[model samples]
Target: MIKKSMLVEKITRRTIGFVLTMLILSIGVFYLSRLAPGDPLQSFYGDAIESMSTEELDAARIRLGLDSPVYVQYVKWISNAFQGDFGLSLKYKMPAMAVITPLIGNTLILGGIAYILVFALATLLALFCAMHEDTLIDRIICKVGTAAYYIPPFWLGVVLVLIFSVNLGLLPSSGAYSVGKSDDILNRIQHMILPLVVMILSHLWYYAYMIRNKLLDEIRKDYVLLAKAKGCTKTEIVLKHCFRNVAPTIVNIMAISIPHVLSGTYIAEAVFNYPGIGALSVQSAKYHDYNLLMLTVLITGVLVIASSIIAQSVNEVIDPRIKLMEESP
Candidate 1:
């Protein structure tokens, strides 16, 4: 009963914390949006905007509620957002959600696939390097991971496009799909390959190196030594003891990587012209589309909070001591 009560209390606190976090993020983003240079109206009228008189520009600001004080605007925005209204996109001149909703699925597919591949490849490489220690393979893995770590994603992406798409004519260079092509599963996969590879390569090296170092530290612990003395083979010790002990750290690292993954997704999508949130984000920024940009910021903020909550929950389950420690304060 006490444990149940503690669990309920923890969840309640987390809920409140997440709400506060979102609120603060919304406020910050709102202010920053105001600070961004250029009038949103310019996106609509371009240089022709100069022909409009001062009164007309003021009327346009009034229509968009941009003439209001910042705090009032924030209150209106937050209130409407709570009710599933994010206002209209200044650039697109349509409801913001109408523009954002479809692009979300594309981002999920791209980010999800790359995320899974990164973890899988990193885990295998880390395990191999850990088991091999200072052998030739371990040295090579370290060197390769270090090199990959320093290679910028944009440059790597451009190089891959030149090789695979331009020179070899093997893959589509840009966009999510071949226009007017049948939307078959195989066709979708072909379009996804290059961007997916870029995303995976950008993240894989850091994670693999981190896991290898952590595993090496775990292998030297007393528990691992005891297991070894108890007739456990190196593989058995690593698989049964070392991995379990390192699991919480791995989960924490993965959680921290969520934002980086999102940011990388944006860059990758832009480079590949994939019609995901990242590409939309670029357009939104270019046009000073406040509503679309705010919506994007809200979604990204929610994902970060969600990832953190998930990591905390996983840590608690992996070792109840974490729950106890958290509950203590």
Candidate 2:
């Protein structure tokens, strides 16, 4: 009963922390986006903004609720946000949430696939490297992975586009799906190939290297030596002992890495013109779509913050000592 109460208290504290963090994040994003030198009016009115009189501009700002002080605008936004009104995207002239809602699914599709592939491949690669450790295959993998790690995602994306889309015409160069063929799985996958490949390659080796090092470190631990003394072979020692111990570490790293892989997804979207939230993010930032930008950033923060909380919970399950450590006085 005591432990259960403590767990509830702990969860309550983290809930408060998450709310505070997001509140601060929204404030910062709201103020900084406003301070950035760009006319939100231009996004709304287009080239006509240039031809409007000063009085007309003033009226436009008033109409859009931008004539007030920054703090006042935030108060209004936060209140409206709680009521499910995120305002209009200046560029799209629609509810900001509506503008980005469909795009979120596209991003999830692209990001989810990349997330699974990168970690799965990295784990396999890490295991291979850990088992081989200093053999020719291991050295070759280390050198090649390091090289791939350094290559910029956008550059890699362009090269893939040129080779696959331009030269052989084997894959699409842009969009989440071909026009009006969104339901065709093959067509969607074809479009996703280049961007997804770039996102994977950009991050694959970096994580593989980290996981490889972690596995290697685990193999040197006293427990692994004991296992080996008990007649475990190299393969058995690594697969059974090292990998098991390293699983929690892998989960933790991958959780913290949400933002990193997310940024790569954004870069991929920009380069390939995939119609995801990442692409919308670029557009909103470029065009000063404040309402749209606010929602995008807030959504991203929710993902990152929620993932970290989930990681902690999972860690406590994987190793109860984590819960004990936190609960200790």
Candidate 3:
């Protein structure tokens, strides 16, 4: 009963924290939008703003609620947003959601595939390095992982495109899909390869290095030595003892990485012209479309919070001691 109560309390606190975070983020974005230079009307009228009469400009201001005080406009916007209305995009002249919805799927596809590949390869390589510790293979992988982690993703992406798409003519350089061609799954996969590779290479080394250090620490613990004294093989010790003990730290690292991964995807998508939220965000900024930008920021905030909640929940399941420790004081 006490454990159950503790679990509920932890969940309640996390839920409250999530709500507070969203509120603060929304308010920040709201004010930042107002502070940004440039007339929102320019997105609609361009240089024609100079030709419009005073009455016409005022009418446009009133239409967009820009005529009101900033706080009043913020209140109206927050109220409307709660009801699922995010306003029209100043650039596209469509509802903000209409502009954002289709691009989300493309981002999820690119981000999701890259995330899985990175974690899988990182884990395997970390394990390999951990078991071999200080040997030639371990030293080589550490050097490689360090180099890969430090290389900028965009620069690496450009290099990959030059080599694979331009010089070798092996893959398409830009865009998510071939225009006017059938959108087959294989064709989509082909276009996805370069971005996916970029994402993985950018992240894989850092995670592997992190995991290797974590596993090494775990292997030094008394429990691991006890298992070794009981005749456990090196492989058995790593798999059964070190990995299990390090899992929570790994989960925490992954949780924190979720936002970075999304940001990286944005850059990668823009470079590849992948038509994902990242590319859309770039276009939105170019055209001064704050409604779309605000929505994207809100979505990113939610994702970060959600990832934290997931990591906390997984930690509780894998090591209930964490909950007890928090509850103790």
Q: Cα-based RMSD of the predictions, in order? A: 1.3, 1.0, 1.8
Pairs of residues clashing in candidate 1: none
Return the top candidate by TM-score: 2
Report RMSD for candidate 2: 1.0
Clashes of each: 0, 0, 0
Which regions of candidate 1 fall more than 4 Å away from where they truly are?
Answer: none
> Which tens-of-lDDT digit does each residue in 252-325 have in candidate 1?
99899999888889999989988988889779878988889999888888888999999989999997888788
The lDDT leader among the candidates is 2
Screening candidate 2 with a backbone cut-off below 3 angstroms (N, C-alpha, C), the clashing residue pairs are none
Error at 225, model 1, angstroms: 2.0
Positional deviation of 291 in candidate 2, in angstroms? Answer: 0.5
In order, the Cα lDDT scores of the candidates are: 0.89, 0.93, 0.87
> In candidate 2, what are the lDDT values of residues 242-313, reduced to their tens digit?
898898899999899999989998999999999888888888999999999999999999999999999989
By lDDT, rank the candidates, best first: 2, 1, 3
